[model samples]
Target: MTTGVERLFDELGHFNRFQACLYFAAIFQAISCGIHYLASVFLVETPTFLCDGPSNITHVLYKNHSSSSLEEIWTHYKPGDGPVVVQTSKGDQWELSPCSKALRLNVINFQYDFFGNKTMESCGSFLYDHSEVEQSIVTDWDLVCEKEWLAKLTQPTFMLGVLIGALVFGDAADRIGRRPILMATSLCQFIFGVTAAFTENYYLFVVMRFLLAMVSSGYLVVVFVYVTEFTGIKVRTWTSMHVHAAFAVGIMVVALVGYLVRVWWIYQIILTLSTSPFLLYCWKFPETPFYLMAKGQYKEAQELLDTMAYFNSLPSTLKVSQLKDENDRALLKDTKKHLETEKRLSILDMFGSLKMAGRSATCWAIWFIGSLGYYVFSLGSVNLGGNQYINLFLAGAVEIPSYLIGCFAMDRVGRKKTCAPALLLAGVACILIIVLPQDNDLLAIFLSMTGKFAIAIAFGLIYLYTCELYPTIIRSLAVGSGSMMCRVGSVVAPFCVYLADIWIYLPQLIVGILAFIIGILTMLLPETLGEPLTSTLEEAEALGSKPYTKNAAVDRLEMKQSIKA
Candidate 1:
């Protein structure tokens, strides 16, 4: 009795309906990825009324001899009629003209002046400086909890979870199987996600988030490996690009939802809980033919391959044993090595005598720098304007084209050609945003969006490029470590957001320069387009062999005529 997935794969080629479903489901799971920095839109940065209380406001009204009170101005006069009623760091409130609002709120220009003089807020035309505003409003550490700065400790906590999942789960996939581990990760994702949503204290939320992050990484690593392994040499390139593009799409979707939803925890609930059901569907999913073979489950692997061939109506030659490829054999050998070794595999194993260590390490560095800049740029969108949502969406929307263009070019021009230029352009773009006038701001916003476009491509290309360089055995470990570097980057990205308080444009400029340096460093890496996805240590040691030209690959693919054709 062939399983439903087996019957389906019998019709399709190497892809059964179940595996196809998992692929799409996994991509959609990208939505739950940590976009907290962008999604923090509503929880903070909200505006308040200036005449919020009864003291000087009433006195000022009486002194004016007007029946109209300050409260009336707040009700009747919005920011256009007068300055927006914004709460200062202090408990005090103020009514100033819109021009004065900018001047007063220009913490970069004015914070020092107020600090030296002991006053931060100016009282109307006369300067009644309330300098204690920083101490008062910035209650994140104090009001939230004095040691709350430790909340930033979230990244490392999250990283610890990620580190555990990548090493543990990667090894487990060999013994326990890919589909089961993925299913388990998904359930864990749901549990931790729902748990994190309800935490009472900030620390609890952080801890739950850390756990969720680990769960999330497991699914991602498995999905990336599963999808790429089943993909043909021709489609693998584009499929890899799409996986990462899905992540960017996830970020964009979260930003839009945050804009509409406008609450922090609510956004988490949306991200985490909303996707749990897909995991249910995933429970019924089938294993990858490539993965099953790697585990020495040869019979099961053949059944899957034959089933896939039947479903896709591929040439009958694709049946069972016939589906074998050179890469598939290599994958089996690597799995055997991992199994024979003690449960622990050191990071050094990735480099061991491979002479590929230098290349892999550099790839991780690019991963770190790329992620750091991308998220820093993203998180900083808030200060770009209070309308961070629109800016973020626009920045994100631009990635669709960036993804397409990058996938199209990465193989044609080689990884080096595409990656270095993308990073360099992104850096130049950041510098462009910095030079644009900040306050007379439409042009500024436009230029910043342009910069976003550059970084978006840079982000997409890094993952695709990294996949090609390292072999399959440590692909997840290498990529996960790279992704871990990204989380490290995300951790540091918030601190860059902190920089926005002093000189709003400075963080952009600094992140841009960092991006440029990454591009420069990328020149050191070999172009892996037309290269093999190595299956084990020995092949990786030699630097995976270049396999086919992008054009030749494309021609071969076109000749095959896919469904999209």
Candidate 2:
């Protein structure tokens, strides 16, 4: 059952200097993606602000005082007596209201209003407390007050682009070549990302960001498939999971950069420019031999295999004759015929039978919950009562261990056990936040971080599990469809955070309930721990009807040896 390309990988050695280089190159892409995807967290952050008052009041108040002294004069017109003290477990903390301004009836006395009715009105303009954020979309466009909804709208718009890109580019990579799509998307990501920083208006900025997100999603999808195709089964899981770790590193990098560079547009430019160096070396990148062999270009596949073998210090005896036997040719013909017949099959076709429908639905739901929980935790971390930069850093940092632990658990235990427990733990962590007092910011932060850590595990597990549940014929379609659901979850994440405005605990409550429900529902899924990947619908449907004695470790070793023989 081993493909000729996979056998070529065995001859080249599964893990080698050449493969290491390719792995690092792909890791760099994932890192860039994490930076770009989460950069919006700082870009649109809402800084503390208060009403600027009417022009008459401002002119009269500042007529004799300089702009530097306006802070002294401005205190007389604030709504509160002073900052209100809220008792916390650590100590008492002062909180200020930023939505209203006081109107003075007479500027001369500035005191008698205590006896008369004090007038208060909504802010016509605003003054921001720029101690933390020097500049942001929220400050530049005044996205507070009534305009706050516009700020929350930005992330969902970007995720919408991701949804569309998965549909379009997933298929395009199949029709054209993975290398062309990867290169094209990389170029487009740079152009669109940089252009977004210099936009004249908010609407233009949103449009540019949408285009950037679209290309970014395409690049990630194609690069992942390209890397997987090149890797032998022995090392594929390690390489794939580490790509996500690289993504976490990117998230940490953005947090560090965001802390250092407080200006939003400059920060945007820096993140976009980080990927520019990849363009210089991309020309040397080779197409996956799997793609070449699948297209019947055995000569090119053989030559690439020889180059890889030489670089890996293996013998260069691999040739087109070795790559294509009568059996392989017949198999290729049958595969080609099957592909042609199923070319028009949609995601809905995945539900052709009862067992297929049940498995597909579970996979899709898990995908949705994973994405929803991941983004909700990430975007909501800034709102936790601590240093926003440190909070974001921890959010990214926790994912590293989550990926490591998730990978280990999947290999040692089973995918079902790993995924279900993680989801349940995340649900419990998030739901517990609702019972804590509002002033208990420290405990709230701890629970949220725990939730983030657990959800990261579940999110990572879904990627590997979904691939194993579907047949190779519609594998890409299954992942793409699941990804669409994931993107839908992401698109809804910001709004979930926005729900905090109505009730402070509303977002956490919703996310927790969904995670808990899905955790239970995931038990219905078949465990694919040691199962071989199915190539047809019948084989896929029969995956978990009976248990197998083989374990993943032994199965992997056997597959590698079979390829060598």
Candidate 3:
């Protein structure tokens, strides 16, 4: 018998204007999230700077020499007479003194004062070049020298908020319907994001940013679920992946915004305000009919289906009676009972069977590996030897083709075939960077972009693959638990960039090995292409054990009913 959801999908029609608008609305949130999550990459950039070298010289130069001559004079004589070179812990060499002699101001004129005491002193303040960026967190707060770690910690701190948000919000999204959570999070993201721009202190900025990240993370999860719930099985994968594509578009947009706006605060304000329209527009979209049916709100479900039908320019043929007619009423009651029965299913239950245990563990590992690779490639852009803005933009742009390729390949070759090789390719690309000469920067960058593309393909495939692996009862738990691990990977990504100080290739090597190992493990998973979605734990375990034809799941359900009888 057709489920109420099936009937609703049939009546409402697929790929209609109503669903299209909803997808666009969801994409708006995706774009905002992409910008917000990575905004720190540009806002806190460390530009070329040196100690405010001898203000006395600057004073005299301004009073005597023309402004045009100042640059020429400063450039000529700034190098130390005998440079005090120091090697960093990472074995890189740097000069201790920016200038050897301090220039002096005579009564009415400036002089280079060559005979002035030649001594090196620790820098008290810095002067940044304003040619590129007007102001960054690095410049505003002087996060150089001993405070450099503060700048490096910013991404991780926001990621920590994401970690906390995933734990709390994923559950909240499940408990409350997806729509309310989305609305609340949209408002919170706007408020906290705007507040972050005006924060006077670094700590306060971190706090506001944390809250913003938390809400933004919730927005991601809720929107993903909300969009998935409304879409039919035929168009579901594309609809969901399109949100991720929107995220890539957001990254490019942020790169453009950052390129144009030189000041950190202004860039932030632009991103924050971009979310304002979502606050009002979100209300126009209705709750998913599935959630309404799950909560036993049959009238609301019918009303929503009817509205969808009308908006789709189809007849309002769906009715409440058609949903709970005698047969489906019992089925609906059984579904409610089934949901209640699965409520007690714990994380331990995910490992109840051997095949399930292996599947869960392998998928979890792949999630961690994929997430680690994705963020490491993305966040590592600032460190790449090129125009940071251009590098960041390319990092995002490279993923677009991967998403497109994934959408095409998964349907033809199946999830395992596509994902396993994608991981291998990503791993090989990252490892290849390790052998390339550092002087061959173009090759390194090309390899890095290739790795990102491969990882993006794997990342998209894993979401679909994971969804197919678990039964409906434990689906949320399985995906949520896996996402928690993804957050852990994100939290660790910043440290990978930091480790570049020790060995530039260390992070890549680690991620590469993990990817290759996980790729092998991914192949162990059963191919789920064209198989019916598993509705029960038993069916999930039995999936790859036999020839899973169209009615196999139904046959199992009938067998269970007969045994009970």
Candidate 4:
């Protein structure tokens, strides 16, 4: 049956100017999340570097060529093909070994070692190719060679913070309200993001990045639930999917900004500053009526509904007397219920029964696999043998059509069919890469992009499908738990990419097998295509096996009787 708030939504007109304003306002948060999530690709990129030569070589060159350019003088010691023959200021050509310096011998008589062994020693410092990225954490903190593990740890650490944020903010929103969490997270994202840019210490930078990611995840979860509650069923799928489309746009923006601003700190500043407009949500946004009604705050729910009706230019069928009557009845019912049961709803409640447990497990597995494949392809895209910026931009660009296709498929074919096939297809695409010729960079990129395309579809579908699968009371908690699992997959994604060193095809092979298995598991989930958003646990548990009717006639009859009374 439709809840009181949902019935009011039907009368007030779904997808009106009020809902439109809120939907667009929430898009900025999604964009900010996209930028922050993938900004590390450029922020920590490893540039082409080599061991700097010995100090004696530098001193000798400086003494001989007093006014010579650094590039001209360093050419004698830098790596190159054969020995470089340089014409000195005296108009004499001298042969210089690129990798070695002769002791107690003339510079002209130095011979280059081309074949087997040379006396190689540990580098005191390193030289980097700064054509692409002028500076990054790798260059600034020397997170290369022996210290490379620290560079790899940055992303997983950020994801860990995101995981914790999902748990904290998810439960808090359910208990307190979505509005406060949403506002607070938005403000904190800005604060931590900008603060991360200014920290000179690498560990301090990582700490700030972790905090920023935490708030970003919280903001994303609350905004999704808040918008989902306000939207009607007819347009919910597209609106939710569009939020991710906005996310893809943010990824593309990162590529653009990363290309234009090669300095890492400056890029961070710009990305965080762009999201400052979203802080206005505190002043403009309203608390969702579904949450109010679920909490038995009928008067507050009715007032919000009246405001919605006024903004949408519709007649308000609810009256103060009707709200008071319902409130009184609800108070008495709650008084009796509280005496009977003291248990509260939580993420654990989703697994309270065997059937619900089975469904929740399937949802969790799907989330895990989806996140793993999505991020594995995302982080590996930059290394796919082309311009990193262009490749990253294409990675985000391909997702737009994927989300559109997912929206169409889920709307027409149902959520199960859409997500399952997409996962299977992504698996097939990734696994096929194992057989490609080693030198075929173009074909390898094509298969990788194909995997990204299919996984993007599945990734987008899971958010909308999970929202529809759970009831309103525990909806944010369920999504948050699912997202927490998603972060677990993301936390492991960097290691998955690192697996390429063990075996060339290892990463894709792993991703493929996992996706294939989860694709089959996804079929066990209930189809939530056209169902009303269930308001209670009993209604949610009956989703797949039971057939529900909106019963417009009965709802109108009840509204008339309540108005008359």
lDDT of each: 0.58, 0.75, 0.75, 0.74
What's model 4's TM-score? 0.80
lDDT of 3 at 147: 85
Which of the numbered candidates is closest to the native, going by highest TM-score? 2
| Clashes per candidate (backbone, < 3 Å) | 25, 0, 0, 0
Report the C-alpha lDDT of model 3 over 376-479, residue by residue, as the tens digit. Answer: 98888767687777877998999888998999999999999999999989899888989778878778888888988989888877777877787766776787
| Cα-based lDDT at residue 132, candidate 2 | 72
lDDT of 1 by residue, 472-527 (tens): 45665676677777767756666776677578888887888888887887787777
- Candidate 1: misplaced stretches above 4 Å? 1-20, 34-168, 263-265, 313-362, 467-484, 531-565
lDDT of 2: 0.75
Clashes of 2: 0
Better of 1 and 2 by lDDT: 2
Candidate 1: lDDT of 317?
A: 52
Q: Which scores higher on lDDT, 2 or 4?
A: 2
Count residue pairs with overlapping backbones in model 3: 0
lDDT of 2 by residue, 434-531 (tens): 87687888888889989999999988878778877876667767876787889989889888988887887788888899999899988888888888
